[model samples]
Target: MGVTIAIDCMGGDHGPAVTVPAALSFLRSHADANVILVGREEAIQPLLGTAQSEFGARLKLRPASEVVTMDDPPAIAMRTKKDSSMRVVMDLVKAGEANAAVSAGNTGALMAISRFVLKTLPGVDRPAIATVLPSMRGHTYVLDLGANVDCSAEHLLQFGVMGSSLVAAIEHKERPSVGLLNIGEEAIKGNDVVKEAADLLRASGLNFYGNVEGDDIYEGTVDVVVCDGFVGNVALKTSEGLAQMLGAMLKEEFSRSLLTKLMAAVALPVLKRFKQRVDHRLYNGAPLLGLRGVVLKSHGSADVLAFSTALARAAEAASNRLIERISERMASMNEVKA
Candidate 1:
């Protein structure tokens, strides 16, 4: 049997335009995978086109009466919009009808609905939005990207353990290095929260690499970077802004002179390759770790390729037994305490 993923068709800014074609493209790429598109039937059916006839059986639809807007408060949506697309998709994952659910919806709503629907693992205090940061050497997993803005030391430690487990499972690292995202490398550089978490992480006996500075994220010094949502969000946005600025600057440089344009012709391939390596959308999806089931949050502005990338990630997360690895790690931690 193939991997099954639940996709929220009405979640992004582009809505079905991005989601439907993305699903079809994924189906084209991975013949064994099944995509369950969740949204209004009328909105999604036409996107499938004539391919709908052959793939209709493989592509299932689960109707969602409403959509949670990007501006909607997460608490209110979770409480009131019980039949929303985010809710329905998460429900499918909780019930095991789907192996994973991917959405480009509001980050807050996605996190809240996922937590409310799937619940956290036994030992986990919260579910975090962990994202993968592409580095010069490889990718590093960063957690609490915007889930809980105010987190405790215990919460940070939990993020460390979860991130470590995830990176290990996905990257096949026997013991992935875990780093506390801090202001500086020294243990005393951060406030009380980071200091305490670093202590706890060291005590937990995992491969703690001490504190890693913000600049270290792209250097790929550690396999997992742990921080609270507030800090992680700032870092994520800053990096994204820088990427955009660099692209714009390169465009200006290429347009300046005829000689530069000739140079641009020679450099276009190299620049395109570098952009692909650093593109956030290329590495857009990451598991909402600590949930009982897999859930991937794609970029809100995700195009067709980004959507297809997320689909592949969802399939990999399921096939690799990510949840099982997390459970095993939790069990090991519990056994040590006992």
Candidate 2:
């Protein structure tokens, strides 16, 4: 009777090995949560193991005959893999059998299928991928994290509206500030598309913060950062790579000598807290906003802890009625335009 999430169990890099356990872990933490695992039963059943009995009716398996692989093209996957775990999970959400769908699969395929199946919310032209990131002030929500490569000025304006709604829904912030990502903080910066988008945002009844550079993301200068998919994807990947390199370098430096090793020992607890603060796994789920139903995309290479975080995010979005909030915001924007 509680919220049920349909999971694409065989979608990620580690497939059921990562997803099944993550779902079980999520179930343990959220007593009122239920999961419908969509994958090949033979492969997923083994992973469930003893947890099946322990979890009982809260867990169910819905067999998927095929899988959409990482290398699979979005168009081909959409056309051929109708019964794939990814599509099946989405189908559950469309049928009202599940409150949301979570998948650690091919991002392109997930976006395409979700858009096709669930359709877009009224007044929304396209769906954008929005995720939370650690920031100096606290956290920031950035959108279009690789959904549409070439977006129009109108699309960007919609991204601002949707992103603000998302932040307000999840962070409980009223009128969260929205920033248009650009090369420079000046209004004259960026191309024609961005300039037009900025003008629209300024007039669109949003808490428009004008412009923000790349550093503004980490600085938490704004609650939501909006940009096209190409730029957003590059920024997201660059930050992830930088985080990995920094963590590795710090580890190497701390273990370089006996003195440094002892220093590391003294700083162990502080280091752990620091790691927890910036851990990418803690921010695993990226919500595909503007969709009529809840659809969350996890990192393709996510591990158990990371995938569990995605499920938790999907549950939170479902509970908060994120899609409904976006719809209302879009309707209001349309009324303003009229």
Candidate 3:
């Protein structure tokens, strides 16, 4: 499906320098897309430049006077930075002027602004940050990545429904399996909240996969993994840290001596494939699901390739009607409850 995505041009660590180019790259790959670059025109336009002429009306710029910084608190951003690029992109989505919005901005601020501007879909008690992680089965989707810190049993169930809907819409999967992140595989292993959530999931008619441990996340035990933000965020960060440490260790070992250097040369091809398999850039976009519109968050330090991945994710989600899929699932869930 054709889509128009509004980008927060001044958001990430690289600002317009990275975002503008990333949007252009994405547009080249997706012939049916339109992009609006929103930021300080002086900064964005110079970067956008004559290249805009290549795409003509397909590419345009919208000006925003302010920029949201990484240190800004969510409340401060929402109450103060009214004209910030991050907020303006969200406004575009809320206004239906864009099918989706993307930003590599302050996570807390982006979530706060997006939740406030777009509101939650009907029957959605809260929004969740669903991110793709490289896994044994190609990849898997995990949610509540950092959105709701403390979710109730009912909230976990809601995440399952939203996550399942996301996989269904974006990947065209029917009856995607959903698993609750827990202490063990047994139904009785977790705390009251988790145990109750498991029961609710089992009864909710979703393709519940029972409780999965932290290791199960990378094992690709299920299509969607549901957890509260605190746990999910910890898991996400731990994975990132582990990947970085492994890279450092490998570099250290490979450069240790001539013998090791020759060994590394021999293993270079295998290492490259392994790196590609775990490359976070391939899965850079994290959709803030349950919102009224498609809103994606790119890593704050994402390079051009990673940021382009986020833009592509936003367009795919919009094209697949992610919000509509979630709404329909929620409606059916409510009907079952009734």
Candidate 4:
């Protein structure tokens, strides 16, 4: 059987409207893939419509009575929303009914519920959110994206190891180089925690490239960039805001006058290509790395294409045995220390 993915159909801002279509698109692209749509039957069924016949056995619906809202507190959602679509999707993974789970839900709630249900991998102190970001050299994998705001030097080391394994497994890169995200590239430039983390990473048997400044992330100085959640989240949000602002400014410039409009018409193709290269939708899925089972968090405002991209990522992670690879890597690291 192909990899089965459980999708939280009622989780995102757009809810079923975005998810159902995305699931359908995913099924169409991935011939061997199957999806278990987890949400209220009434809410999801209408969206599926007659397409169910087309997908047939490849698509199935699993009803979930409760829905977790974006505003729900992590603790409250974990405690009271046991039957929520997000939790149900994770439950399917735990039950071996699905290889992975995808949700465009509240990030805090998703992380809390996933940790509670799937637990952390062996030797993993905490789970980190890792995502692919556009870089000038190509792309780079960055981790600890808003998962654990307060992380220690040890945690940063673990993030490097986990991020390395993730890139190795998914990108098929051997010994992918890892860089420590810091204020400066010099060894003594950062604070005590970052300095300590850099030392640990260098000795941790990973392909550590020492400290990297903020610009190094887009320069693709390393295959993986590791940092505490606070720094990582700030970097991610800043990049997102910059992308949006640039796009808006470009649109305004293109519409300024007849001359600019003509120039835009001539450059339309190039602009389209550039947009495709940096489109956040193409990289919407951020895996909650270190979890025992595969779980991906899609952007809350994701549309069909973005949600479908997340589903594709979850399937790839499952097929590649990403969790198992991380576990084995951690075990080997422990053995080396011993």
Best candidate, TM-score-wise?
A: 4
Off by over 4 Å in 3: 185-188
Per-residue error (Å), model 4, residue 219: 0.7
lDDT of 1 at 37: 93
51: Cα error in model 1, Å: 2.6
Per model, state how many residue pairs clash: 0, 0, 0, 0
After superposition on all C-alphas, the RMSD of every candidate to the true structure, in Å, is 1.7, 1.4, 1.5, 1.3
Model 2, 8-75: lDDT tens per residue?
Answer: 99988899999999999999999999999999999999888788789888998999999999999999
lDDT of 4 by residue, 1-338 (tens): 89999999998889999999999999999999999999999999988878789989989999999999989999999999999999999999999999999999999999999999999998899999999998888789999998988888989999998999889878889899999988854565888998899889989999999988889989999999999888999999999999899999999999999999999999999999999988899999999999999999999999999999999999998999899889988999899888
Error of 2 at 213 (Å): 1.3
What would you estimate as the lDDT of candidate 4? 0.93
Tell me the tens digit of each residue's lDDT in model 1 across 183-289: 85455588998888989899887899999989889999999999999999999999889888988998998989999999999998998898777777778786899
Candidate order by lDDT, decreasing, is 4, 2, 3, 1
Enumerate residue pairs that collide in model 3: none
TM-scores of the candidates are 0.95, 0.97, 0.97, 0.97
Query: Best to worst by TM-score, what's the order?
Result: 4, 3, 2, 1
What digit string (tens of lDDT, one per residue) describes model 3 on residues 253-300? 999999999999999999999898888899999999999999999999
Candidate 2 vs candidate 4: the TM-score winner is: 4
